[model samples]
Target: MTTELLTPAEMADLVGVSVDTLRYYERERLISGVGRADNGHRRYDADDVAWIRVLRCLRDTGMTIDQLRHYCDLGEQGVTTKPERLAMLRDHRAKVEARRAEIDRALELIDHKIDIYLNEAAGDAP
Candidate 1:
């Protein structure tokens, strides 16, 4: 099987990020191994796309650039760094869980207020 390659625009579309964001990730070294075409345009292969997806997940989950860079660095070190990577992910997961709990609490409060209004509309008392 052959590996598929994508142009910068195609990559951005496929990854649901702007071309500028792709370029920014490249500049920040959050993702790497983008090839240059004969005309000096950037080309991304399947692996690059996979890495970009990982970067997207990390960014979406509020991972800082430095933390992402560290994670990527550990990933580049091969399976020997699995423990370190797992530790980092565990730490990040805790943060995400905490944030999720806080959002859940706020959502519960909103639902309670909505319930009050709904009950009042139904001619119910406090």
Candidate 2:
């Protein structure tokens, strides 16, 4: 697919976020401005779209705004923050694992309820 330059709205649509959210991300410095058109409108490329996808992934993984901003700051400085970024990712992974455990417990409870219903229907339980 041709990765053409897109306007803010187009980029927002591609990334599945609102235009306001894209602007907020720009204000927060989570993503860099690609540049501006002659009419002073914001322009973005495929790389910007990819970066927004990363931002969304981080948000989905429960990284708070402060955490994202910190990560972005470190990223701006290049590879010097590799160790710190790894630490942050490890911490986020722990949180994801904990959430997964909670979901598994809930699924187990649901299965138990289903079993109870099935047993009752079979006249195996009063």
Best by lDDT: 1
Per-residue CA lDDT of model 2 for 39-116, tens digit only, reads: 999889878878889889989888988999999899888999999999998999899999999999999999999998
* Stretches of candidate 1 exceeding 4 Å from the true structure: 77-80, 124-126
User: Highest TM-score, which number?
Assistant: 1
lDDT of each: 0.89, 0.88
TM-score of 1: 0.85
In candidate 2, how many Å is residue 50 off?
1.4
Which lDDT tens digits does candidate 1 get at residues 31-52?
8778988899998988898889
User: Which regions of candidate 2 fall more than 4 Å away from where they truly are?
Assistant: 1-3, 117-126
Query: TM-score of every model?
Result: 0.85, 0.83
Query: Total clashing residue pairs per candidate?
Result: 0, 0
